[model samples]
Target: MINYLYQEQNWKTQLSDLITDPKELLQQLELSTDQLLSGAILASEQFKLRVPRAFVAKMNVGDALDPLLLQVLPHHLELEDHPEFVTDPLGEKEANQLPGVLHKYQSRFLLTLTGACAVHCRYCFRRHFPYQENLPKNNDWDNIRDYIEQNPQINEIILSGGDPLTLTNAKLELWIKRLESVPQVKFLRIHTRVPIVTPSRIDDEFITLLKNCRLQCIVVVHSNHAKELDPYTIDQLKNLTKHQITVLNQAVFLKGVNDCAEILADLSYRLFEANVMPYYLHVLDKVKGAQHFDLDSAQINQIYTELLAKLPGYLVPKLVREIAGEKNKTPLYGETF
Candidate 1:
């Protein structure tokens, strides 16, 4: 059942107490250096290990190839210099308007709410993101509000970053009220991996905050495999759905984690069971250190085809890739060029 309803350790405490040391993480998992290739430890120097204890609880002890572990564990492969894979693969910097704001699409803007996350996946596209420079000043939020007020085309505000949910309820609600003040803004979307990595994050108070908000709220979460959905996590997700809150799950097609059709099919089935709709099944962004996870369009098409045969169309996520300067995500079906 794996319930995080413990009285002692709250989400914040668990987050602060995350396993940052790669050696400690390996020791906790009963793994040895012999199991990992050289540069695995050195690679983590660039983006230090950050895995929540609860998330690590999901990994199988002594299993070197555990899918969840594979996603977070630093590898020697990350050091490989793939010429195509660069730091800013999606060219997010070009669209960055303010320290924390990015007006990427015509009508939608993304706000980097915070540069903090409970888990740091090794293949994260933003692993090299310049968060320290981009994180806004305490009072700079007013500038963001004013920017929204000035722009009439912007209707949707996507709260992203390391993960928006990492902010406290007071902070989030404060920003939500500010966003609600903008008559032009109609929808508030949040992209996060909190629930999967730290299920206790969706406590009663958090749910109540969303229920009380006036703007149309949508929560998009990240979960690559079915195994991430422990009973407690699914219970929280189902709770959101029951409250009439729209919840969706997004996943990246990692070579070792969930590239297989069988695993992805199981992931879709499990997501539906948890009352979450399958959303974007993203092809890996060509970011440095993550080239090991990339899969071609043809491989993705075959997997999507299998998903169509096994499940209804509604359960299949749109397999898409984000290209630099593209208006929207380029759907993998048609020619990407």
Candidate 2:
């Protein structure tokens, strides 16, 4: 642990120097040119490639079928032009009250911290999100704070974004301390992918912020496969849990990645090993450019059922679907939250 801590560099430095060109990323992994063809290159033009070197190192060199590579490497299938796979599949646009504030659930308010992310997964539901209009600027936090005060029923503030942990520790602590002033707010749920892709982000200062926050901190890490949890990532997760911060994972059930029962079971075990609970094994949101990753409910249920047999009830995550305009997430496994 001491060795790992001493070797850690600032994560923001990593973010600025990410591999933006698909060719560069492909070359870095020693992938053949045929694997990342012209159409695949064209597909990522809109979303753009944003993968850190730390994450690229995890991929299997020269293997196009590698799960980690398949996630970030955009394919021609993304341009399927499916009608149902529209932008804003979760209806987040409609719920956007203020620039940063999204009010959909009564008990919680989702605050869009920033549009920046360390890595952009091809299956990201927010691939088409209008960051220009969603991210708040100067004086926006003031309005968002007042809005939170007005809604006394809102007890949880969801720090969602491109990834909330991308912010500086001082900035996170300052803003979160302001959030603690809200008497109604009890929990701070930060949805992030940094720990999985950019484990260096969880440094001593980052852990300090988590420990010092007045509100109960829940770090919902986005990890699709067990392989994402490399030794460094697992060590960082241990550091998070050492501070007694609640760590949970939300996995997207992608078509080629972790679709099988055994894979999901293995993923659950790996998460448990790191003291992170399997929270939601979500069906891919029908977002534009992400139809390639979508799987049917019957298949999802079968996988979940097989997972139930392989592990204890607690290890199984809820097979859930998020329907736009629905009051809550509609569960496919007949379980309600």
Candidate 3:
């Protein structure tokens, strides 16, 4: 459970009051700074540390190997150069057609509303993404709409960013209204981590906006460990399901964080408990700074094979890898019944 004091504060206040300093995070967890702090500080120089206090509260004290902590903690390994790990691993630069628009697939169009996020995962594929150059301005909406209108095959619009929920309800509504204007767009999919990291972001206003929207709304939340799904966060996710909104989860198969089959199975069950479906278990994207989190194919296949045996078919998320320029996410796991 989250602290009662934290629960009382507004989501924006919580967002603004994140733990950015590496020393403070280590101190708060009562872990020694001697062995960890230097590497953490160095790595964080590239991709600054950002994690909510509420999210930090979920991590076990005095344990450096805590799964939730591993997901956010900066490490010295991130600075090492890997040949295959490039800055733009997904080739998003080429796909970036217009400001804030990424036309990756034939049917789905992605819009980056804001580059702000509540929590900064250590293995984020977009750590080096040039968000400032790509963010869509209010004036740029017309161009985005024009592109969507011209692309007749586009039936879905994805709301992604540092995390779209980081934006205010009014701002989200503004873009959503524009998407609603497009007669061809039938689905509005939001890929966000705010609901898991800062559950308070899912307030009544946002819920109402999603519930009343003309387009079929799907909110896909990112969570790697089951421990991140506290009672408070679970209740917030349940609020979406109660209103007939579709909720799904996509987790990265990080090496140290959630590499075990039992942990993956537990996450599936926890998501199910909140009425959220397990969607995609993505293999780590070969981003330059995130190479440390990548697992060998044999390790990935072995864990996933065990995972398949443990969970029901519906609960087992499809193991996939997002190859650059590929038409769809490539499924990595072999056939299972």
Candidate 4:
């Protein structure tokens, strides 16, 4: 288990600066302490890795109170104790028939464009995913296209990976063009944290590409805490809306993060304020190394009920957990006090 005291002191000293430039960040990451502990450290554990210099400069370093760092830095993950935690928590790779394509649930096909993430989230279920084995090939599109073609009822195509937005605009546009060729596809959702972690990812060119797409573009952002959204992030979100993209946020319930009634409620309100609808408050996925962050189902139900009581119906996000083989996200309600 990670001692909060040690985490705070260590994080304070280690993440002295934030950097966002991908190339420079990659260089620093190459030398990151986290790399040395990759297979060794549990996902919940705290270790000092170099934050992107650009991302760090945005933090209120003097305050020693940065939400960005909390998401990325490794804390003391209880690897020895968390025997139940497995390497593949969401059963992601097993759904893959071809590289980059995951046909898990009905009506939805997930394209793993790239395995690079701007921020390494502590609670990410896919942290241990084997990306090298799944790199998309030029002809992989035909395979994915065929899968979607076989399932005419499938209307949604989800672009997810380390973050699909990690792909260059040209590459993403090519993928979008191919998906658009499918007549049955109506919804194109891009699940990403890139814009939140590095708001610059949402430049005008990126917004324009989605705007031009035929399918209804839905950008599902992952932001756990309200503090993660600042004026710059709001501006980036605004750009998405300006292009008529529907912006939604899905937050994972983490232990030290936004686990409280007030914190979660405020997050919903803030996302609304930024023109993004608060969609789902996910119970932490049962991924190994992330067990420490899981809130019990009973506790999650209590929080969900309290949120309903506090916020208006529309602002309250649904509390749910994903169960493999289940057709839908199991809504956690009517169970706890």
Candidate number of the best lDDT = 3
Clash totals, every prediction: 0, 0, 0, 19
Quote each prediction's TM-score. 0.95, 0.95, 0.98, 0.83
* C-alpha lDDT of all candidate models, in order: 0.85, 0.85, 0.92, 0.72
* Candidate 4 TM-score over all chains jointly: 0.83
The list of candidate 4 runs beyond 4 A from truth reads 1-66
lDDT per residue for candidate 2 within 1-337, as digits (tens), equals 4325423656787777788888888787777687466756888887887888778877888888889988988788887899988888998888899998888888897888789888889988888888877788767878888898888888999999878888888778777887898888999999999899888888999888879888999999989999988777888898999999999999999999889999998899999988999999898898999988888777777778889899998988877788877877777773432
Model 4 error, position 101 (Å): 1.4
Q: Write the per-residue lDDT of candidate 4 for residues 13-122, one digit (tens) a residue.
A: 32233443323433333534444345324432332243434344444443322555555655556354576577776777678878888878888878888987766676
What would the per-residue lDDT of candidate 1 be over residues 223-276, giving only the tens digit for each residue?
Answer: 999999987788879888888889998999999899888999899999999999
Candidate 2 TM-score to native: 0.95
Residue 236, candidate 2: alpha-carbon lDDT: 86
Which residue pairs does candidate 2 place in steric collision?
A: none
Question: Residue by residue across 285-312, what tens digits does model 3's lDDT show?
Answer: 9999998898888888899999999999
